[model samples]
Target chain A: MSTTEPDNVALNGPVVGRYRVIPLIEKGATAGMRPAVASKDVQEALALPGTLVADWQDKAIKRLGQLVKQRRGLRVFLDNCTKCGACTDKCHYFLGTRDPKNMPVARQDLIRSVYRRYFTLAGRLFPWLVGARTLNKALLQDWYTYFHQCSQCRRCTVFCPKGIDTSEVTMAGREILASIGLGQQYSQEIITKVKSIGNNLGMKPRALADVLENLEEDILDDTGVPVRLPLDDSRADVLLVTPSADFFAEPHVDGLIGYAKVLHQAGVRWTFSSQASEAANFALFTGQHDHMRDIALRIRNAAVDLAVSRIVIGECGHAWRVAYSYLDALVGPLDFLDPAHSRVEHICEVTHQLLTQGRITLDPQRNAGKVITYHDSCNVARGASMGQRAGGQFRIPRELLAASVPRVVEMSADTTKQKTFCCGGGGGLLTDDMMAVRIKGALPRAQALQSVVDSDEVTHLVAICAICKTQLSSVLPHYGLQHVQVTSLHHLVGDALVL
Target chain B: MLGYLLTAAFVWAVAGSAYRLIVWARTPSTLPMPLTPAPTSRVGVVGRLLLELLTFRALARADRTTWLASLAFHYGLLLILIMHLRFVWSQLPPSLVPFIGLSGWATLMLIIGLSVLLIRRIVIDRLRYISSPSDYLHIILLLTLAASGTAMKRLWPVDLYGVSQFLQGALRFSWQPLPESLVLVVHLSLVLLLLFVFPISKLLHGIGIVFSPTLNQRDAVSAQTRVLSGSSHSKTRE
Candidate 1:
């Protein structure tokens, strides 16, 4: 079984035969993967009120026991792993960091060991024999270091015969850590921002309106079309819930433009809610259900206040998963919305429906200058479904892209669809301090992408998720593929949309 | 004494397994997390479990070597277990008699499968890194059970009629005299230990598979309506 190798020799690290052994470090000193301690403000925002330095070990153990019973995935996954090691080489972090702790089962053992010590008879009687350990400051620190290293992508689950999802384990670990106030600053800070300002980036209503208005002007200047980016229009037919990054970031902004053009051509009345402008839910990354629910309810309120018949989510992977799989449970029935369409639909599904119905027209020639390939976002591919089919998540975006682009290519089979690799900055590890880990974690996807680029001269790599656009664009230059552009699926659609 | 000890071990195994099952059942599955490409119907889920049990589907997709070894070990164990039914039955079923001879091959396959797994765990760097003392102990325990059982059959033959009479008498609530063979005693003791440990060890994976939400739940997302508990009273204005 030959695996695709990254084009950049340095990305391969120190290779012995077929395996890469990046020396395991006790801590993340070299990769700078350590997150700052959650500030008191962030902790309070998450409703996890406690002192960071307090002796909360007993409390944490009790909380974990409660969580294991509450979350079935956690309980079953912890008990199910046979340490078969089928998932040992499956994690991108393990491949990149060469850290044994990064291996999915080992990463899981950090929590499972403690679960055994507290919850299982064998663990209580013979801890060392079963590899169980007591909960202590050292174990907690290991939990913080290793859990954050995971992207919670669920790749390991697909390969695990027992169907053990390390993402569930990672989420449970994060939840337990947060209960003791040992939260990751990146995700916790974002949750705080989303709570106070209705978005991860903390952009206020005024700034959001200005950004949208400016984008409308840019569309007119570039395409000679008077496209409108409406905001908070109560009578609109669709409520556009998008990530705040789309209003500010480079390639993400272009994807936003693409969505606008598609809706404009389809003649659908859509508006962005400044109050609930953000779609990225950082709370899910931390496994904070209350925080996630509070964040999702804002969108429900936006949809209700606007009297929008339908709600359409923007290009964000994990956010889409929360919207598709969790929103209904968190703040739904959503019974008042249009029954003709899904209560919450992905932008790709909306565009695909429009193209299929001939509600919108696209000129493939407009996107003929570049050969494009789609990178299936981890959460969307493995976590959520689109349309009415099982794999609509994988097919819907590609269908829309193929409709708008003259040529489309696929990366290696091993790295696409359910086996898709993370862009390495997901699950709230996108902070600048974690760049080394991010770059290393992204090697597999980069190598797979690099293979296609070398063979097919694929000029553009498009993704539906905002984080993928940001992460890949940043990491591409590091692998000497600086010229290969990373764009959004909607970016190409917007480029080809005909008025 | 052996009969009483064996009965006690069976009771412990059954009670422990039932306790584990109750705990698993009590755990709340707050979310539906079926891995996508999963079946959306109850019938489909059954089919998925069947495929998983018969083929070790996911492991096969992951690594062929481990899958082959595991398939041999599990199926070999199953056949060996079925062959044990002959001792409990006074009249062996005609259909099953033809396959009695295959028990020798089954034992060999079990040992070979276990050796492959043990070797991989010891030799493979990645596997060795994740393995604990208990992991190695599991394989060794099974190997000893297989070796002792096989030796009693071929190397040091036991009193089959005496063993059958004792087993039948126990089932009938009539305690008969035990078979006076050292090899038989060792084999029976090993079997008793395995049963006691089954529910407490990683062997619980046998039961865990049936309850795993990712593998067993139906992916009927649209069909099921989730009733949101609390109303959204506080609204953030745009």
Candidate 2:
């Protein structure tokens, strides 16, 4: 729909190539590339269009009606957007892909147009005039292609005049897609694993226990002290819920080690619960409240069973948002716990607090070799809070970096803090199937990161979100920043923690 | 007959707006999803909204150019509307009497704002690409109305006393002769068109922003848990 069709040169160039500006696409460049959803996964999740319902069009419309009737923000977001384009260039995907539909307003219009044609008075009367479109196979295909392209980063929301969050709109879009059994395989599979196995990786209690024990042994071998990674200990004071990736994946696992060392240093009795091993809730990515609630209940159940006074989440971006913002609301009345402390906390906040009170000594000299910069995770920056203060989410991580790292560098002003760009791997687009868009969507972040690398020989890029770490690790290499090591904020904390 | 038509248009605008708002209010947000770094108190929420309304705070941060032009347009319209209150109210506070002298300038400010917005829409790639036929229509409609109003002020001045008497009479069910000027007729007709489309078109954004959950929800103890239901549809269903 954009009048400015992208030049063919930009379209053919490598995603990492230096460009004066990313151009907007004409059409069909991305329309054919849709994330596939397995029918079996749909059936298992009990989401709609499970191959049993051949009439996906009706099921989709019915789901849309349910969302419009239920979500207050969705109703306003759908009905009110004046298409001001305040958020047009704001989305990382739009900047990367140059797909006009990736522009927040145009993306919302994908569903907004359909919603209008079926639901609104003007749309029903003058569909073309109001830019309303009747739902069809081709449009449904566009839903998958473009909606998945969005990382649900909410960078656009910070600048929107109406405060319409494109993440919220994309969530609703994904939810509607899920309803008709057309959900993305990456997120749907993760939700299935989480629903059945308690973690996104589907790691069982025994394997998780083995992983923690191995980490403890490794920590003990590295340092003479007996640092512990307690597994499912009922007597622990804090129930630490972290992403399953921390148990296996590099850098993430290091962040997990950082949490263990911090908890150990503070002498706070904390343990990981096998039953609620993952903090990154894929339900959020899929945008189903019921699914999110049912999945999140495992965390509460784990806390109740362990009888922990507090729940501290490790470095996972969307998980932090789900916990810090949505946890108490999703499954609440956490009255059994102590009233003085918040029910859920970020590991960075815990470390920051300990650093503030001098409970733990951090030797920033330990990280002397690296020039560091911190990347604010989308969900944490825009969707959640970390400490008692208002902008603590932004402050706490940087404060930790300041306390624990010797030399720190700031990125360009507009691209950090509330204006931070997405790492292009969040909102469940972390799958290999979505690699093209992930690399493309990462253009803004790469540009921002590439700037600091040139200006100040920044060697290390630290992030607090798991998806950001993983996404950046894979995508940054394309931009010739393979030398810029993307590690966790807690991994930095873990490195700088003194015996 | 014109008075009755105007009354019907106003009623349509009001009722349609109320229906939309009621539907929005009735829909539960299910979770506290305030864009973070938000106000923690109800009073703080009010303060945030006030800042946004009075200054277009979010717009200002997002795009400075649009923000300045929008401010010129909206505040100018506010001033003009205040001056126009004389037609509906027999008299206003004497302090406002001083501002009435500036209505012509206010109208000029509105035209200036509308013109810039229109030019930006045409010139900017991102805006032009995302813009639809309806967006241009909305601008053209407002620009035409503003042009007509400006014409009435300088080039084709209307019978002000008669127009006021007619509007005032229409409100109280008393008949007054319609003002006999083409510019005034065009301006009045455009006003009616705007009001009629207020609830139907993107013009509803004025009301829509008030109910936007991102703008209105509180971050303080974000666990307003009792309202968050997993299957709200089951509970809401008749």
Q: Residue by residue across A1-499, what tens digits does model 1's lDDT show?
A: 0112233225434222222232343333323346666778878766786456476788789988988979988898998899988888778888766778888999999999999999999999999989999998778878888888899999888889999999888888888888887887788898889888999898999988898889899999999998889999865778999998999898999999998998888777789998898999988888888888999999999998888778889999998989888888899789877656545888888888888878888888998878988999999988888877768888888888888899899998878999988899999888876777788788788878878888899999999898899999988787777878999888889988888
Q: Any runs in candidate 1 off by more than 4 Å, and if so which?
A: A1-32, B169-173, B222-238
Q: Which clashing pairs does model 1 show?
A: none
- Expressed as tens digits, the lDDT of each residue in A331-446 for candidate 2 is 98777665555467778877887887778899999988889998988898888876777788898898899988889999877888888999988998888767777777778788
TM-score of chain A of each: 0.94, 0.95
State residue A327's C-alpha deviation in candidate 1, in Å. Answer: 1.5
The lDDT values for all models are 0.83, 0.81
lDDT string, candidate 2, B1-238, tens digits: 6777777777798898888888878998877778778888899888888887788888888888899899988888889889888777877788889888998889888889888898999988878877878888888888898788778888987888888888887767786888888788788888888888888888877767778888888885643322211111111111
Total clashes, candidate 1? 0
